[model samples]
Target: MTDVSRKGSLSFLNPFKTRSGSRSSSRASSVVDFKIGDDARKSSISTATIKETNSSGRTSRAGSAKNSLEYTRSSRQGSTLATTGEDGWDRDAQTGERKDHTDLLHSLVDESTAESLADKAQAMFIGIPAKPAADLFSRFPEGVWRRIVEFLGPADKASLAFSCKPFRTLLGTRSWTDLNSPQNRDAKFDFLGRLDEQLPNHLLCFQCGIYHVRTQKGQEVLRPTNVSNPIFNCPNVFNLENKVARHRITVGRALPFPFVQLILRGQKYSPEHGIPIDSMSRRYKDRDGEWTHQTRYVVVNGHLLMRVISSAFATPALPPAGLRRLLYSPSDNFNPYFSVCAHWRDGNLMPAVKCALSHIPKPPEGSGIAGTSAKVQYHFHRPHPIITLCSECRPMRRCPECPTEYLIEMRVQEDRSDPDPRKLFKHAVVVTRWSDLGDGSSPKSLEWAACNGEAEYDSFTALGKRAISGTFESQFTVDQIPGQKMVSMNPNKIKLGEKGHDWY
Candidate 1:
């Protein structure tokens, strides 16, 4: 019964103990081999056998079992054959054999491959002799070269082509073509087009008022003239009779491109006293206690351009309110008419004339009523052809008969016996031809005329005549014109005394 029980126990535990013992012993053997420096040979063999067993086992358990039993028997016999005292020596021998086999395998495959690659590289390098550093362009086809050129920046592309002859030939061709291409030419044209668009329209002159047109040739033309006449018989000519009746008129014609015509009227002032008023003044008081005014028109290019007149001078007897209302009335308002005819002409508007007119009071010249004897002079003097006013007054037109000269003068109007009268007036006058002096074309020949109370004529014409006649002739030459001399005024020289006060 004990034997039977022992057999049953063995049947149950034997398989498990055997498998466990074999795995543990294999692990222990690998550890021992590693300590003795013989692990490489043994580990390789053991791994190969295990891998084979695993692979074969998947086919059939019966075959795996047969191999396992055979492996156990061989392991036992080999262990017995291995001398206990000579284990280390045998391990070293096996290790040397495994190393030799590995080296032979590597020599058969890796050595030949490495040697062939080295020879091929050496041959290519020798065949393609080294030249000066060059671009990759020669190595690539034309299409690929174009793509490389496109990818390269301006500076890099230039350097690559210039570095070597072969690269230069390849890159230079495309570079030259690119520079002269139609696309490049079109780009230049587009740049010029933008520049042209930024330029302003130019003014052109015809028989009529000025017209605005493009700078380009054959540009659209738009003329501003009188619109009353639908058909412009002579578009450039100024008709005085028609202008006086309807003031100024502008006519425009649309060219290739439709354009709007803008007409700007000139500034106007009163004709009586040469004061600018809102409306034209019919009557004016003179120094002789007389009331009269004359309307004079200037025609340019056959068009009535400017009309000059004076405002009505009020007497001391008129009421202040009445004079104020009369001067302030809208009917007395006036603006000068400026007509332009040509484009690109210098000096479109006269700055001197504009400055002179700017000082004139708007609409009303004085605050007092009409007929008031409040002493009032014209806000501005008459416009003279010879006197150059400002930068805008270039190419001034001077009368051959009467040349003009400018003078600055100061005067004090004091009642008799008044100790401290504060009625001082300073004035700048541009005097015209006094007594038919030769044309005032040269500064050396120009003379200065006096503007004082004792002068014969109060008008600019009379003053001009007096100056030309040399009524107050002095030893000084034309070069002695006032304001021509420069002097430095020291602050210490200024005096607070009444008599010295007039020196300023």
Candidate 2:
């Protein structure tokens, strides 16, 4: 019997305890060797022993050949493979193939898996219906709302309301009220509707007359300052009086006031020529028992007085020629008109008639011509107070308390050597009352006509001529009372000179 004893650390298990036989021995040893080899390879033993002889003492020896063979077989079957474990690969069981662990992990969590998770969570949370969006301006305080409205321009405010439902509900009502408020006076709608009409083109004053012209090109060209330019430098400036003098010669053609000529005709004098009278006797006693003589005369004082009262000469009449001319010619061959000369001073014109009458000495009271008295006053029929539209002149006019009336005197020079001799004619007619004609709303003064005696008629006629000639002058005074007057004067027909006059 071959005896084998397990020694050292294996002393506890007896190696010689099993039966020994030739056939049994060989099979049993082979089987035991196989089991030992399997245990060494599978359990990772540090040492291996061959039949207890020859103790070579190699403690770190590798496993026996049989054990190595068994390990190779197990590796091929992919049951238990010994590896360095550096690479991240694991052997497969059935095919014995190496597969990447990272690849396997990636396959488990892919795009489809992440999508499934997200869909499930979204379905769970978003199941309920959504409410409408809240109004953006609902929670704003009143102060904030006011600020917001102010920040938005007119167009922006209108557009914001129409943008969306919530904005319309909150801002539309408030914006409308704010836009229509009186504080927004410069707003397009407010200015166009209320202010534009009442103050169109502003106010203007030209040559003592006030007017309102329309605005051109959306702007007022002539400013209030421009209207007052003439009056600004000197309120008493009468330079334009000369322009009026030049205008008189062109009466009915260039003169602005046409009615003045008509008024003058009624006052023209027609006196008999070559009537010799003594220069010393101021009174002229006619053939009749009634005596006609000089009376009070009118005069103007001021720088403009001379210019305001001047006479305009009339053109000669055309000579008769055709058969129609005979029909047009008057049966009375004598002309009843005469020309007079006048001068302007201040803003007034003194008629030559007044000057001629003034040259005659005033008779004593109770004399045959003593009852005659001459007076002149302007009648303002429009009734409204005159407001000075010209800024240069402060508002001034005749009023009951400070009545603007004057007593004036005129002087006439008689020079025989002078080429154009002075002449007089009888008054054709008298006008007691004249209509106040013009647009009443403006600051225009009333027009006057003659009333009563031949002297009065001639006075008015000369006055008309002066006005049309642009030689009419006016002065301010406080002597006369503020009331209407009616007076009369004597009538006489006389021839002025050889010069023929045309009726205009």
Candidate 3:
């Protein structure tokens, strides 16, 4: 038979034998043989292993094999066979032409063996035994898992928790308190460390885990230089720190406190100086309930002296529209309502105070006093004292139409050595009902439409006696102090709300 005719009848017995009664030349001296199974029934090779031979018929190049032999597999039913053609090419028999050699060496097994052989083939390809899928996260200890989770950002952690049931259960099941619990001591430190790494000192309140806007420039005046120091020395820093420490102690670890007080003097002082407006309208039930709106103002020294006269103008550099409109409006007039100021020099809390002189909820001292009264208290540290004033009253006015008036009184000493400072001066308006109080009154002192106590009255505030009355002290605390101690001397009460004194 011809080469083509012999190719059709060739079997596993003598695959390279020719019909012309001759042996086909072997490409390599070493012949590799393969067998599918021990079945006596018809068997077929599934892949055509081919290698190009040189003209001299020596062994082929190191990696010239075009096809590889897959492990032989069989079943009781039957098997399909595959072999190369005599022309030394793989061909599609129906097309009678050579086929491309890119196809993989895969087998066509009988129905009974298909699933078994498939699994075996897959396992061999992956180089692993078949088993049920397992949870990769559960395999690790909780500590390792927490470390991994800590590495992710808040957004990333949230996303991860949402991706799968197991992850959600692992992360969401723990409350914030649980995550911060003493049992997870390492985790709390890790969290704090991460916070330190990511959050800037100004933005972070290390004491309470609270974040604040760095609204004013130069807000942070002092920082503890001793890295070994466990507590923040500054009050502002420590106040927040103390709050956070208490919280963490309840939930997890207690932060060391009453830490050393290391005051660094000479740092720049940043004051919250700006315009604050308060306005409200009400109908007096006693006078046919007529609606009357009242607006009050607190003018900062910067707006009064600097920006008002500057030729160079920017929208932000201009005074608040409310302030400008109140100043220029017809019928409405400029009035000085309230003034409060605090000063700091070289890190020392040089005398700071608040004065309540006007708008006090009183019946002109004897106009028929009602069972109502109010008081204010101030607190401080070094740079400045944080002062909070809260008052309550119960209808102290003779006429229901008249609201009760209240005052804030604060007096600080200047030149501490002075036995007496000429009266007192106020940096801010203690009280006034007039929104138009921006004019007529000297920018140096706060004035009012009328004074109840001429010598004692500084400003005024109007509140319903029956409504809100509670002595609410300002929760103020000085955040910084001068490191060196200065002799606080015979300071006299600085004249406040006085005409000639300069408080700013």
Best candidate (score: lDDT):
1
Off by over 4 Å in 2: 1-197, 200-308, 311-410, 413-475, 480-485, 488-504
Worst 10 residues of 2 by lDDT: 426-435
23-45 per-residue lDDT for model 1 (tens digits): 44333333222333454566665
Worst 10 residues of 3 by lDDT: 305-314
- Residue-pair clashes per candidate: 55, 44, 57
Q: Return the lDDT, model 2, position 493.
A: 30
> Which lDDT tens digits does candidate 2 get at residues 325-365?
31121322321111112111112111212222323333223
Model 1 alpha-carbon drift over 4 Å, by segment: 1-147, 150-166, 186-504
On residues 102-209, what C-alpha lDDT tens digit does candidate 3 reach at each position?
Answer: 443333234435676778777676955544323666688868877899887544555556566666766784533454455744443334433332333333334443
lDDT comparing candidate 2 with the true structure: 0.28
Better of 1 and 3 by lDDT: 1
The alpha-carbon deviation from the true structure for residue 488 of candidate 1, after best TM-score superposition, in angstroms, is: 46
Prediction 3 TM-score vs. true:
0.15
lDDT of 1: 0.31
